[model samples]
Target: MKYSTSPTPSLNNYPRSTSPLPAPANYQPTTASAAVKRYKYIRRLFKFNQMDFEFAAWQMVYLFVSPQKVFRNFNYRKHTKSQFARDDPAFLVLLSVWLFLSSICLGLAMTLTAGKVALFVLFVVFVDFIGAGVVVSTLLWYVSNKYLRRDQDGPDVEWGYAFDVHINAFFPPLSLLHFFQIVLFENVLFRETFLSCLVANSFWLASIIYYLYITFLGYSNYGKLVDSDLPMLQNARVFLLPLPVLVLSYLATLAMGWNLSEMLMHFYKMRVLQ
Candidate 1:
C-alpha cells in the first residue's frame, strides 16, 4: 500500500502576510496639497541619504549657463509626472549647503571673528535667502494665480511651484553676489573709486538680469504648458521691464559715487559684528 499522500501547501491556502509593505525609497505623495507636500519636503531636509544631489548639481550648472535646458526638463516633468514644479527638495538642500560654505569663505576672506562668521552664515541662510525667498514666492504666487492665468476656470499655479521658481532664479544671483564677489573683494571691487562702483554695480546689474531671465523663463514655460490663448511668452517680457531702469540706476550709482559692494560689506559687518 502506498503511503498516505499529504496535501501540498498553497500560498492562497496559507494566510496572506498581514504586514504592511514599505513605501518606495523615492515615494512621493502627489495627491497631497501643496502645504502637505511642503511639510513632507521639510521633513526630508535632514535625510541626506535620500536626496538626489547629483541632479541638483546638474540643475545648478544648467541654471547658470543653459536655463532653457533646465526648464525643458521641467516640461518633461509635467508630461511624465503631471506637475511642472519640482517634487524633490534636493536643489534647495544643496543650495543651502553651498550658501553655508560660501558664507564661511566670505567671512575668512574678510577676516571676520568666528562668532561674527557664524552669525553671518545664519543671516544669509535664514534671513536673506530663505526669509526673502518666502516673501517673494508668496507675492508672486498670489500675483500669478490671480492675474497671469489665461484661464480662471483652469488650475491655478501651485505655491510650491512659485517658491521653486524663486529658488531657481535666486541661485545664479547667489553665486555672483556671494561666491564670485568674495573672490574679487580682496583686491579689486572693494576700492572706493568710480571704477569700483562700475564693477560692483555691474555685478548687481548682471545678477538682476539673470534673475529676471530665469523668472521670465519659469513663468513663460508655465504659460506655454497651460496651453494659453496667447502665443508662447507673450506676457513673459514683463519680467524684463526693469532692465532699462536698472541700467539707468547703475549709471546713476556710478555718477553718485556709490560703491554698492562696499555698502553691502558694511551692511554685513553691522549686522554680524554688532
Candidate 2:
C-alpha cells in the first residue's frame, strides 16, 4: 500500500538551502515491531523526500545504538512493499548456496590446522553467517515496504533504508571471517587447492574495498565497469554500509577469541557424538 506524508519535494529544482531543519522535539527514533510498520515509516519518509543521505546516516547509528525506539516508531499494521526481489525463491536459493559454499570451504580449512587458532577461525565463520542472516532479513523487510507503484522525487523506502541496514550489519563480520577462513584453508589444503581459497579471498577483499569506495566516491565507479549504475551502494549507505560492518565484525570475533563452533562441537561431541 502506498502511503504519502507530505507532497514530494522537488529534486529537479532543489532549492539551495544552507541550513537543515532542526529535529523536532517530539521526533524520537525507533524501530518497527513488525516488517509492515517499518514499511510504513520508511514509505512516509521517502514519499515526503525526507529520506536522504543525512537521514540514512542517522538511521544507521540509531539501529545499532538504540534499536528499540527505531522499532517502536514504525506503524506496524499498515505497512506493505510494492515489490520484493527475494519474493523470487530462486534468488534466495542461489544466495544460500553461495553463502554455504563460502562458509564450508573456510570451515574445512580451519579444521585442518590442528591447532586452537584454526578452531577459532571456524568460530568466526559461524558468526559471519549469523551476521549475514541479520543483514538479509532486515534489508528484505525494508525493501518489501517500498512503494514502487509510482516514481517519486526521492528514493523509495527500500532504497533509502534497506541497503543501509544490510550493509551496516553484515560487512564487518563477513570480512574478518573471510580472512581467517582463507588462511586456515590455505594451511590445511595442499598447494593445488590454495588457488581456490586465494580466489575467494580476493573476492572478499575486493568487495570490502569496493563497498568503502562506493560510499565515499559515488557508485559511479561501478557505472564505469557495468556501463550502468548499481543502486545497491546508494541504498545501502542509508544504514551503515554493510561491507565495513561485516569486515569489522570479523575482526571483533577474532579479537574476542571465542570459538563458538568449537564450543558447540565440544558440547555435542560430549553429549551426543559419543
Candidate 3:
C-alpha cells in the first residue's frame, strides 16, 4: 500500500476566529474620559464656559495683563461668530456703565453743573465708546479688503473680527488712561491745552500700536483659514489700515473736546459780562 503523503491544510484557508479580540496592551479605556474632564475643568476655571459679569471682568483684566495670550488662545471662528457684539449686549452695557460712572466722577471732581455732567456722560458712552469702535472697525474693514489682500482669491476680512480686534486692543489703554485722567491727574484736561492734547495723542498712538500687534498675531494664527500670508509686507499693509483710523479718531475726539471747551468758555464769559 503506497500511500502518497498529502500536503498539510494551509492556514490561510482556515476561517477567522469569531471571538472578540482583546484590547491592546497600551490602551486604557479612561484616557479619553480623562482628557475630556481636564478640558472641561480648564474651561470652567478660566470662565470660558460662561458669558457673564465675571467673564467680562476676566476679559478686561486679561486684556491689560496678557493681551497676546488672549488673542492667541481665543477661538475667533467660534466666539466671533456665535457671541458677537450684536448677540451679547452685556459687555457693551458694562462698558457704557463704566464710562458713565467715570464721567460722573470726573465731572463732579471738576464741579461741573448738572447739564454738563449729563453731556459728558453721554459723550463718553456714545462717542468715545460706541462711535469710535464703529468708525475704526468700518475703516479697518475697508482698508483690509482694499490693500491687504493676500491674493486675488483670498477671503475678505470680516467686520466682526476687525471690531473684535479693535475692542480688545483699544480698551486697555483707553480705560487705563481715562482712569488715570480721572483719579491720578490733578486736572482733567483732555484737549484743552497743547500738553493735554499731546498726552491724549500719545495714549491713542499706543493703542494703535497695540492694535497692530494683536492683529498681526491673529493673522498669523488664522492666516491659513483666511488665505492670508504672514509676510512682513502684508503685516505692514494691515498695520497701515488702522493708522489713519486711529489718527482720525484722535483728531476727531480732540476737535470735539476743543469745540465743547470753547463753547462752554464763551457761555461763561457771556454770563460774567451780564
The top-ranked prediction according to lDDT is: 1
Off by over 4 Å in 3: 1-50, 76-87, 187-233, 236-274
TM-score of 3: 0.55
- Residue-level lDDT tens digits of model 3 in 196-270: 655555555675566676656544443232222242115534554667777777778666554333344355334
lDDT of 3 at 153: 65
Q: Deviation in angstroms for 4 in model 3?
A: 46
Q: Write the per-residue lDDT of candidate 2 for residues 15-121, one digit (tens) a residue.
A: 22222323221122334333765465545543533334444445335543553333222212112222211111222233334455555554544353334434444
Sorted on lDDT, best first, the list reads 1, 3, 2
Alpha-carbon error at 258 in model 1, in Å?
A: 0.8
Distance from true position, residue 253, model 1, in Å? 0.9
Worst 10 residues of 1 by lDDT: 19-28
**Local distance difference test, per candidate?**
0.77, 0.39, 0.54
Q: What is the Å distance of residue 173 in model 1 from its true position?
A: 1.0
Model 2, residue 40: displacement in angstroms?
Answer: 18
Clash count per candidate: 0, 27, 0
Task: Judging by TM-score, tell me the better candidate of 1 and 2.
Answer: 1
